[model samples]
Each structure stands twice: as C-alpha cells, then as structure tokens.
Target: MAPLALLVAAFLAYSVPPYLTFDPALSRVPAPPGFAAHYGFLVAHILFGTIAIVGVILQIWPWLRRTHPVVHRRVGRVYVFAGAIPSALMALVIAPFSSFGPAAAGLNVVAALLWLGSTIAGWRAIRQRRYADHRKWMVRSFAMAMNTLLSRVYAPLAFLGLGPSYPKLGELIPAASTLAGTMSMLTLLLLSQWWLDRKPKKPAIAR
Candidate 1:
C-alpha cells in the first residue's frame, strides 16, 4: 500500500501542476466545445480528485487507523463529503463535453456515477455501524477515485499502441481514449473486489 501510494503521489506531482496554473493553454487535453466554463470544472475536478486520492492513502493505512482512529474518521468525512462527492459531480458535468467523443463521454458518465454511488454507500455504511460493509464500499470508492491515475497511464499507452497501426490519428483518438478509461476503471474495480474477498491462510497446527 505504501509503495502504491508513493507511485500515485508521484503521478499526481507530475500531472497536477499544469492544471494549477489555470491557463487554458496549459490544459492537459483540449477542452471540448459548447461549454463556456469547461476549464473551471476541469480544475475543480482535478483539485477535489487530488484530495480524495490523498484521503484514500491516509484512510487505508493500517497504522493510521489503528493508532489515530479519530483522525481516520474525520478524514473519511472530508473524503466523502468534500473530496469524492464534489469531484464526481464535476466529472458528471464535464464528461458529456469530452473531446474524446461520445463513447468516452458515456464511459465517463458511468464512472462518475459509480464513484459517487460507492462513496455515498460507504458513508452510509459507517453511519449505520456496518464496519464490514463500510470497509468494502470504501475500498471500492478508492478504486473508483483512482481512475484519475489509471486514465493517465492508459491514455498514452493506448495512443502509442494503437497509433502506428491506425492510419487516421483523428479517428483513433476517441476510440483509444474510451478504451483506456474503461480498462483502467475496470481493472481497479476487479482488483478491489479480489482484495476484499480474499481469505487469509489458516495457521499451522501445533505439534
């Protein structure tokens, strides 16, 4: 977890600075048409996404949860209310205007909804004192939040891998983008379920 967190932090360091500049020229991808405030929502999504990812790192740290439970709960509240929910709402707003095309836009919408729903479920689980359910749902929520990282990783790979083989760069971009986002989110979701369901090995019998 520590290593993975470090990797995500590194990626965030690399990807987040340009957005912070708030210059339209510095936009990572071309802003889609028909939206006057696309850049504003993009920045908001990035900002809240960063907070949510950081919250996941802190929340999942066993040492933090064991040693500083109060901190864990407080951070969880911030994550659900301030980080995950707002970021997802922004995603819903911006996804439809995705420059990547209709397929990517639809996928983004689904991902945002899943992220939002899982987060709300996690919050409700904790409030209801269903610790087991809370853990499952929160882990799932973290996986959804992590689409930010995986999307970046996959997008370039999708371009490079598919670009040379395809003749038309324009036509390929949207397909690659859709494929990348879908694979990234799906991979995380499957992994999270596996992590949640895995059985611990039993101890050896005493002599």
Candidate 2:
C-alpha cells in the first residue's frame, strides 16, 4: 500500500512535468549555463530514476514475485541495468550543482554510491543463491533510490513552515534548504535500514 502510494506520487511529481517545465526551486536544480552535458545528465537521471523507482516498487511486491517469477526478474533487470546504474552514475555528475548547497551535494554523492553498491550487491547475492542477502541489499538500494521523494520534501516543508518568518530569514533560505534536504536524506537512509533489519517473529510452534 505504501509503496504504491509513494511510487505513484513520485511519478506524478518528479517524473515528468517538473523536468519539462524546469522550475529551479521545484526541480531542486539551479539553471545550468547553457551547457549541453548538464542537460543530458539531468534528463537521463530523471528518466531513468523514474524507471528505477517503478521497477523497485514492483520488484518489492511479494505477490508479483510469487506469481510472476519471470516478470519479477525482468523488472529487476530493468531496475538495475537500465535504470539504477545509469541514474546513479549520472547523479554523481550533476550532484555538485545542487541548488541546496555543498552539504546536499555531498549527501547526494553518498546516496548515489549506496544506491549503486547495494543494488549490485543484491544482484550478486541472488546469483549466489543468497536470497536473504539479496532482499536485504535490495531493500537498502530502494531506500537510497527514494532520495527522489525524500529530498524533494524538505524544501517545501521548511519554506512553508517558516513562511511567517520568511521576510527576515530570506537570505538564509539556501542554507536552510541544504540543511533540511540533507537531514531528510540521512533520516530516510537510517530509517530504511532499520526497518529492513527488524527481525520477523518466529511462528509459534504447534499452536
């Protein structure tokens, strides 16, 4: 239920119109100085990131994995080979230009690294028949991929929550954006790992 809601919202928000309209604040990227490479990476990142998010969402659904094994593998391939890897690589290229600041940029770099690492590790674990490890690593990877949803949240929350004080604090808005955005990313990363690591209770024997 949660994944469905989140994936849908992500596609609606960050996936398309925002990129086409290209609002600096809403898109969370400052305008590049007419550079082609920047535009290339930005578009690639958004397009593939959307694919990764949707792929991860479907891949995590237990029913799909159980009922459609072939589809699950296909989606998993799309998530990794065609989506996450390229998106993460392009993310590393464009992260430094984050309008939020250096802190936000650094957090993005970390997110990209973990996103790629955990995804690849998950793939290798599956190949080695370590299903548990595969699930664990994929959970972590999806959480990193969720930076798309989490990072977009902080700016609005801070700006709107601080609206009454906006006049006086206008100059500090950029710093506030960075602080809120970076903290959001870290909080999501930690929470996701914790959620994934919680042990399921053993079924009562002979009940």
Best by TM-score: 1
Query: Which residue pairs in candidate 2 collide?
Result: none
The alpha-carbon lDDT assigned to residue 28 of candidate 1 equals 78
Candidate 2, 1-207: lDDT as tens digits = 585666567555645776766544555455566554776688788888878887888898888999999999999999999889999999998887766557767877888988999999999999999998998899889888877676666767767766666565644576567656676778877888788878777779933
Q: What is the overall TM-score of model 2 with all chains considered together?
A: 0.82
Off by over 4 Å in 1: 204-207
Q: Between which residue pairs do clashes occur in model 1?
A: none
| Predictions in order: lDDT | 0.90, 0.79
Residue 125 error for model 1, in Å? Answer: 0.7
